[model samples]
Target: IIQGYGLTESSGSVASTVGPEESKAYGSVGKLASHLQAKIVDPSTGEALGPGQRGELWVRGPLVMKGYVGDDKATAETVDSEGWLKTGDLCYFNEDGFLYIVDRLKELIKYKGYQVPPAELEHILQSHPEIADAAVIGYPDEDAGQLPMAFIVRQPGSNLTRQQVIDYVAKHVAPYKKVRRVAFVNAIPKSPAGKILRRELVQQALSMGASKL
Candidate 1:
């Protein structure tokens, strides 16, 4: 099935692809809908990015919700003065006009100034023969800013060492993207839709004294 993208603030879909021609492009969420206007902007600088540059996505249109109920502060933060809603999603568009969602801006690991996508490392961790599932999170670190931490669920009866997991990720990714800490768990927290409950893991890490890392 072709994947489409939308949000509650937009009130409905802001982009979708239809027809056989559009469906064949793997990983694309399709093109932007005609009525809405969209732009990509650097999260830190707020400078608008051109097509093919990965950045935060912002959209504005009649369908976009005016503001969040009862919370003017949140409304102000989310919807800008120009009526654009900051989707807080990292994305990029190809030359063919197909949009691809990368990951959430809030979930990205800021390691020493480089932005590392946790999903990329998590994919490689899950590919290991002794791993069943995995999740990646950024643990607070004074020297490096934030270090990537891996929470894994091993294959039943499999015993994996911390160094083994860390080495596997280091081999696949750059130095900035390597998994620095490891935690083995039975299962990963998830929503009903099977989305990783990242916030819960963040809380877990903090409670377990992640600040020292």
Candidate 2:
């Protein structure tokens, strides 16, 4: 199937795979549409990044909305004065100009000074044979801004331990991106659309006390 990317603010899709040939790029959402200008910028520094560098995606085009209806404040925040609409999505482009969305910018976890994507950790966790499902969240920390915490559901009849879960993720990720905390749960909280309700998990974690887990 052809992959594409867009939002309501952009009126519709601003990029899409042309055909089966371009769709072979795997995770890419193809190239930018005509009349659309796109750029990837370092989220922290706002510096325009080159290919293979992950950053926030900005788009400018005639199709983009002038403003957010009556919300001037929201409009000013999303679309800059120069007409570049901040997509608020962490993404990167391949050398061929194909866009790959990593995750939502706001969902990123700050561990030490490094930005860790929860989706990355969740992917690794779910790959384990003992793990039936998983969701990752940023656990609050004093020294580090946030730590990667996992809420896991084990496979039927599996007897997985917290240390085993932690070790499994540590082997597959960088030191900073390691899953430092884990809690076994019956099932992961998800919305009707199957999107993980991370905010609910965060509130549950806070109520249970981080130290206890």
Candidate 3:
């Protein structure tokens, strides 16, 4: 219900969507808390953005970890020049204080020059009538450097093919956003925190290559 974003070092409690009736907005994560302060910084300029805008999410609070115990380089890279905690999540807060997760800052693929967000593609794939669940990831390609590939789980007793999935994405997303490859899977791998293990899928798409249904 109440979804908030934070890093593992922060104890993963900086943001959470919690409340009995909060489940209505299934995709919108909830806002910050008494001890938490969040701001959006433009990845390129490091300028802060207002509500309803998207950017890299930053957090500052006592709950945030100073850095890794021994990984000073990793800690320095993540904490940045300021004391803010880099959450590495692309998201926005609505005017009413609801947070909406867009995608991961690191997972975005570059096509020619455009940023292709895998989470956006995955959301579209999951919306298909026949799809039970879906995961989208970027794979290396010579032309564009990287492209999205969707792995889907279909509804019980339903039949869907690679081409059908491809056509479905084509119908819904922009040409650049359309998934270049698709693989039907028994289920989409997820973590205990409900996060998809996209890195694994990216590896699979590389070996499996893009194929039409």
Highest lDDT model number: 2
Each model's total of backbone clashes: 0, 0, 8
After superposition, candidate 2 runs with Cα above 4 Å error: none
Question: Each model's C-alpha lDDT?
Answer: 0.91, 0.91, 0.80
Q: What order do candidates take by TM-score, descending?
A: 2, 1, 3
Candidate 1 local Cα displacement, residue 183, angstroms = 0.9
**Residue runs of model 1 more than 4 Å from their true location after superposition:** 207-213
Relative to the true structure, candidate 3 has a C-alpha RMSD (angstroms) of 2.6
Q: What tens-digit string does per-residue lDDT give for candidate 2 at 127-172?
A: 8998999999998999998989999999999999999999988899
Question: What would the TM-scores of all predictions be?
Answer: 0.90, 0.94, 0.84
Worst 10 residues of 2 by lDDT: 204-213
Ten contiguous residues minimizing lDDT sum, candidate 3: 204-213
Query: Mind giving the per-residue lDDT tens digits that candidate 1 earns over 7-113?
Result: 98999998888987898888889999988999999988999988899999999999999999999999999999999999999998888888999899999999999
**Model 3 TM-score, 2 decimals:** 0.84
Least well predicted 10-residue stretch by lDDT in candidate 1: 204-213
